[model samples]
Target: MLGPKIREIREQLGLSQKQLAGEDMTRSYISLIEKGRAVPSQRMLKIIAKRLNTPMEYFLGESTATDTDIGEAVLDKAKLYYKERNDRACIRMAHNVLTLTKDVLDQTEAYLLIMRSYNRLGEYRQALDNGEAAAFIVTRTGDRERIVQYYLEMGRAAFHSELFHAARKFYEQAYTYSSRLKYLQDEHIRALIYLGTTHLRLGNVDQGLEFYLKAEKEARMAGQPELYGEITLGLGKAYYMSEQDGHMQLSYDWTKKSVDSYKLARSESYVLALHNLAVIQLHMGQKKEALPLLGECAGIYDERNLPHKKASILEEISKIYLEERELQQAETVIKEALQLLELRDEGVLRAKLYRLLGLVFHEKDNSDEGYYFLRMSHDLLKRIHAEREADISHQILQLSKQKQKMEYDDYKSYIR
Candidate 1:
């Protein structure tokens, strides 16, 4: 009878066992109580009541109830299905609870869990649909903190889909909610970081930098070194993308700081910091200095199974060879990079590789082949609307034309 009442109240509020647990207990433990196989401890009962916005006595059938006395066996089965990540089964069980009780919270929690499963499976639209429904229900119930988290989830989905503006909008809404709640310090920081990254993606560099700096200051004040390291990394990247030699050096300095902080914390954040530092060093004509850093980055990416990042580092190695006038070695390295790009199916990276190959051919005095590769790179970059690459491609085209004219003039002079 207690189990049935618990399930009834859970359904009436539309909360899933997992949601009711609220980071206090696992979904499996919640199921045992619902099945009458185990009675909830006093502490557990209080948590569930708080999560369901009900009284603990409600589970004991003390208050006026609006649900049937269904057996606890069905609840046990539902818990089992949930433990297996079977969203369909959970939804079915939630429907049964709904039939016996008009619990909006239970329904909302079931929908949210289903949405999360869909999100994990990459069904972005469906996930957004279900998440939006859950958010609507939560909003109506005035669960401000949960509503903010739901919006953040939606923002993450939008960010994954490359909808930067939409992601920013959602993140802003989440931030507003967090501010109103005033108790979610960590959540506010997370929202700020996402907002900063979104601005960076949208080419609003100054705005991005402002947000990152603000986050860094807040993190420092809060004694959160890890968050400080993260924001510092973002600041370094923003500087690197500025493309000025001075700013590139500044980028290297900031990244070095980030790497040191991360190392102190024994975190994996050093991987990206090292990679970015290598890039800046390469651009500064310190190929020898950059090599060891690139090697470290490659090893980390390899361990993480990030083949595309590994290939990118290989491409940088080829660039160094090209700059050093080692045409044969450059050609070999570029060929390896081409193979990697093919395997990874990375169009943007392949375009970069092609441009580097153009430089290699130009160095070998094969103007025609060099121009052809550069043109190919330019076309691909144009298709992607990569403004920085497009500008570089234009410069390459101008240089190629000048080189061709010089070669023709030399040929005429020799014949004369």
Candidate 2:
């Protein structure tokens, strides 16, 4: 740690250990300082500080608990907050780290932590700013591994910000670098996955599945079953969206593999697999099985305190109930979902909620209330640029003109 502090500061300034050791000290002696095997005398320390253009506090941190130790502890706490999904607390602690040390490496780490915190908090623009700042000074001269990490961070920021093309570009750049470095296989796999997922979001399902398959193979070779399970989840999703005649069966198989794998690991991702599995079962006309899975998924979300996700499951449950002529049950669950959504007010999801409530009221033959909620949902969908949803609303509106008549085909299309 002793020599490493000096080396870190030198590296931030784009100086090699040999260059920092020249004229006064031997390179091997400097290596001993970096390796924590030796400490420099006061005079030697002063000379080294002068050459490195750093304050004596940089070296003092190596000897005392003033900065390095305390700053590292703070960073550890920030990571803990991140893991606990406390974005505000993580952001506060990461900012505290910057105040403790002006070291480029430490500051870079803090910036990145703040970036992730902002992203989790739905502050995409702020997250992207911090992400770009994390890499601005070091992209060309910093450690290759660290530079690749920043690329991944920036790619995620772009993805969350809905800049899918930029996200793909950043992931591709990172994948290119990781390809050249055999030791960066982990990052290589991650970059590939992100690139693939980005393309998937952009509706390039084949390309996305290709990358996911590659990632799965690499993860298996690397003995990382968790990573393989993750890729299988994506593969299932991609196949589900594929328009090919036989892809639905492939989707079921891949989704089953991910569900089984995650259940063995006791992982939260299994809940997502369960949701997908239930959706597939509904497609196969097995609503009897799907309802229980959706109910179980909703209970899990409730226990996790994720009201938005619970609302989603509740909405699904209501649609099935409506199709089964369970009008009162549909009204009950849709109202529950609406109340949950009111707490968080995710507008896109809320639009769907409004639509579901409208349909439930229509199914109950309450034309006035049905028309009102349907119109509300249509306005919201148009505002959100959800043209497909707006079109669906248009259909319901036209049906309202026919005295709220919902034909069999209308019922088939009512499951938003």
RMSD of 2: 8.4
Q: What is the lDDT of residue 409 in candidate 1?
A: 26
Question: Evaluated with lDDT, which candidate comes out highest?
Answer: 2
Residue 74 miss distance in model 2 (angstroms)? 6.5
**Per-residue lDDT for 272-311 in model 1, tens only?**
7788778878777787898898998988888987777788
Q: All models: lDDT?
A: 0.69, 0.76
Q: Mind giving the per-residue lDDT tens digits that candidate 2 earns over 1-416?
A: 45777888888999877787654455766777778765664446777899999888866764554576678788889999999999999999999988886454566667778887887787877888877666653342234566677788789878766577778888998897678567788999999889888877665778999999888888877656567668788888888867689998898899888888788777887898898888877877888888899989988988888887888788778777777788789889888887897766565567777887777777677878888998999897676554545667777788777875554357465443
Q: Model 2, poorest ten-residue lDDT window?
A: 136-145
Question: What RMSD value applies to candidate 1?
Answer: 10.3
TM-score of 2: 0.68
- Which stretches in model 2 have alpha-carbon errors above 4 Å? 1-90, 96-102, 119-126, 138-141, 155-177, 199-204, 344-348, 358-406, 411-416
lDDT of 2: 0.76
Off by over 4 Å in 1: 1-142, 243-246, 331-335, 338-351, 361-387, 394-416
